[model samples]
Target: MTAESALTPTPAANAAGLPLALDAVGGDHGAVPNVDGAVQAARAGVRVMLVGDRVKLHAELSKYPGAAGLPLEVVDAPDVIGMDEHASDVRGRKDASINVAARLVKDGQAAALISMGHSGATMAASLLILGRLPGIDRPAILTHIPAKTGTVALLDAGANADVKATYLAQWARLASTYLKVVEARENPTVGLLSIGEEDHKGNAVTLEAHALLRQQAGINFYGNVEGGDLFKGTTDIVVTDGFTGNIVLKLAEGEARVLFGWIREALGSSARSKLGGLLVRGGLRTVAEKMDPGTYGASILLGVRGLSYIGHGSADARAVKNALLRAARAHQSRLIERLSTELSGPS
Candidate 1:
């Protein structure tokens, strides 16, 4: 479909449009959170299709106070791909919710798909079922990190561990399209992940990929940026291979948790510290809430032909609601089609 057609807003008469197919059987905590989140999304005027065992979903939905009247659908899948199931096994099993949800997207029965399942299995399902956008090698699980200035798109969060220069450039283009859609920033600045801003820096892949990204006329390449610059919001988009991107993501999560733990302990240790914390409790809580990654829903799987999101397994209703809104906005913005066109253009 054309970019304009892909993003045309749903008619006012049908505000919610098609229901989003959610792989309810996929997360580590089984189906409870998934079911609860789906109910929450539906209450917000977003219809949801819960894909899992029909009997189980019905049982859970019935337990919810007002679930019976909600705009929800339950798609039956006899078997669920266990959290520990291999990607191949999940793909081979037709009864898995991941495959079924993907099929819903492919069949035009759903606007998008959301899952807090195995990251590997989600990518595999998107690729094998929805297929990749033309000229896009692998689908990158790109996450939107909230920064002080705004939000930054970090790609290849955990998709392709090993990548080529071409794939890195594709990520830039994909992220650029996303920025245009979400931020409405014309010619959004793009930066490569590296140790320093110097021209000759980083390992073999980054150095070579830096040159390639610079050469790509489509992306507004902003040279090398350090890992510390991620939250600094130095650029609109940060491009890196999946290996480095995954490492940075994990390190950031760990550090954020550690810092919060330290702050909590320090404040509670002594009478003076306790009094000081009480004085600044409101400000500290506000800062911590804003800095929390959970404020931003799951990451977007960019470059795929269909809409799919991978959220954290620990995501609560608030995070899931954000993710659903993001998916809807992505459809409304036509970000995927724009990325496809940009990446398919001359490199």
Candidate 2:
């Protein structure tokens, strides 16, 4: 089929709904992991639409047994936006894999989108294609971050570099609703990221947001929380400007990697240490799994008209599979529609 027809609107899906659009190219490792995730999602009963190079994607899918005859379809989209390219650089490449994925959602042929490509390109394609839901000024890159206890849901992970107090209040509203409704966490606490727990200790933007979030109804707003509060699971939902949220996310990921590396080195440093490690292998593995980024899949780009997920460029097959499952769950929960409703309601 031609590129244009491959992307054309198709008949509406059954009541079960359209398949998820998995962008199968432009990842750091290539299309295999993306297709692998698609296969897993299909096996788990989530219909998938693989969007990428026809020949390469099909070749990868053929390598996996039982991939054929599953509720999965492929849309030939050969164009790709490299990780190094700027977001706007994708604007001209309408046939790019990510752009096709977004278009599938736009054309009602896909229920959601999952990709580990250039994040900026993901956001740009999503905005340019699906656009934002009504009443949402900007889309926040939100992720469900696993912690020692319960998970912490953070918003504006890296979407808007510049935002206002009002934007943060919106993030609180959407995040709290998601945690309560989707995650089954009743009355999820909303914490404003700041230097100190005191409300007055933040900068002008955060100070203003503190008041705004406090006034917002339907959310259990906590006072300002510091960086330490994030992993402590001190609050269920943490709201911050994109700049700070991005920093917190990257730093935490880096620290976790370093900390785990240190542990591995110390465990193998001596024979006695190795013996202890063997004894606690199961316990250590349990802890490691919880800390692993793949456990949570990718971050959800909330406030968009449709469900959109963005994973790390270097995500492996496991991460991609988890990301697909997460996106399917988001679609089943009607997260995008619920977020829109909440935003339209009272502050």
Q: Clash totals for all models, in order?
A: 0, 0
Instruction: Report the error of model 1 at residue 20, Å.
Output: 0.9
Which residue runs does candidate 2 get wrong by more than 4 Å? Answer: 1-15
Q: Please, what are the lDDT tens digits per residue for candidate 1 over residues 1-347?
A: 42223322343422457777888877777678888877876766667799989999899888899887777889997787677778787657888888999999999898888988887788888889999988788889887665767667898898989999889988898888778876578999898999889979999898899888888877798899888788999998899999989988888788878898999899999999999989999998877766566566678898889899998877776666667666766766666677777766786
The 10 consecutive residues of candidate 2 with the worst lDDT sum are: 2-11
Tens-place lDDT digits, model 2, residues 80-188: 8999988997789999999999999998889988899999999999988999887778989988666656689988999998999999987888788787656667888
What's the CA error at residue 248 for candidate 2, in Å? 0.8
